[model samples]
Target: MDYHNPNYATSLYHFIPSPLFLGKQIAPNAFQTTPKLHILDLSGNAGCLPEHPELSSMPELQELYLRRMQISVFPAEIMSLKQLRTLDLSQNSLQHIPQGVKDMTSLTQLDLSDNNISALPPELGMLEPSLQVLKLDGNPLRSIRRTILDRGTKAILKYLKERVAED
Candidate 1:
């Protein structure tokens, strides 16, 4: 269920256990405030836009979870969070990486698993300089062959080197 009101500061939203939702549109400016709101959890709510109300203008927001939301495109405006460090968009319906994601230089952990993405944008290498953990297991990418994994650190090192050089 969706709740909307100008004076309401904080409220508990319902948990929808449905696996798929299509065509749900959330009001974008319902939680407008001065100090900034932090932490948003929209998991299990598939088809909800990542750029929903209260999320786009939030200045202090740090952690965001849109996993299993069946999102296809990422919003470029989310890059405005200079203080943002964690983002989880796994289990969605994405097919490509959003170009604006490269703007998030402070991100540490990224979860992109369980999606239909087949290839990563070459610019993703730019994130190698700051990223600590990357989750890309469920993608349909066919380039990373098992032989590459057998090569161990050398393979990863080469991948990183190429990524850094690509920048």
Candidate 2:
């Protein structure tokens, strides 16, 4: 499902090739048409689309899969989906998980494995009591200790919590 090709298969939209050879396209308003769309799986696109398409129109979105999108920047635009419970951003080029993620308090499972993420915002500590599963196994984290990461989600969250307290 490579969005870079535009002809990729998706459960929602069908893409037909246009003569336009636009460098890169970000459909900021694409999701607005389907306001009730809940589970969107855009994984394996391997496309380096920079802008986080504006998906705030869909308040019911519970799960979003942006794995392997080649996304370098954090998709802050779609993070507006406060009801999101599951978010997978694995296998991308992300270097940082923005502090804005703290607003998605409803997230229970967040998969950010296999990315270039170096450090996590201590604000991630705020997701506690709600966030139960966090996948950062394949990332090269700077602030978190390997021992804590090996201890799994609870330990990682605890580390984040402690960092928050120290600030």
Candidate 3:
């Protein structure tokens, strides 16, 4: 499942190498035989992926990729891992993030670009405490005034404060 290898190349649209153990779900007892893993790629498997508790048991998991998985709702269970610092949910069908997502304070980088998010909850700014970079480039939001974006991210930060503070 490690496509990050320096020599990796592919002609197919999408694929990951084997023996790295990529699946929709890893049965509870399945991971006991393997050493603790650092990276887990679950991209494109959310639909068929079983809602298993074991998915979050990897104590050393740092990076998670779940792009284009058609998951509309956020998985709150993954937020419990204090070790996770990066999360990618690009190109999914997510329109709204569950409230519990604010609990993932360990995240330094988060990608939610190209989803169907029309409006982000005010709580999303709470991520700023640890969030260094956030991507919301392609969404159907109809209210971003040109002046706001032109004003730079300060405008967005102010907007998030006003919107979430009201909640």
Q: Which is the leading candidate under TM-score?
A: 2
TM-score of candidate 2 on Cα atoms, chains taken together: 0.82
Best by lDDT: 2
The residue-by-residue lDDT of candidate 2 on 56-107, one tens digit each, is: 8777788888787788888877678988999999988889888888889999
Over 101-162, each residue of candidate 1 has an lDDT whose tens digit, in order, gives 76788777777888887766655556665766667767886645656535643453357457
Candidate 2, residue 118: Cα displacement in angstroms equals 1.3
Once superposed on the true structure, which residue ranges of model 1 sit more than 4 Å away at CA? 1-24, 50-54, 146-167
Q: In terms of TM-score, how similar is model 3 to the real structure? A: 0.71
Off by over 4 Å in 3: 1-25, 28-35, 46-48, 142-158
Per-model TM-score on C-alpha atoms = 0.71, 0.82, 0.71
Model 3: lDDT equals 0.65
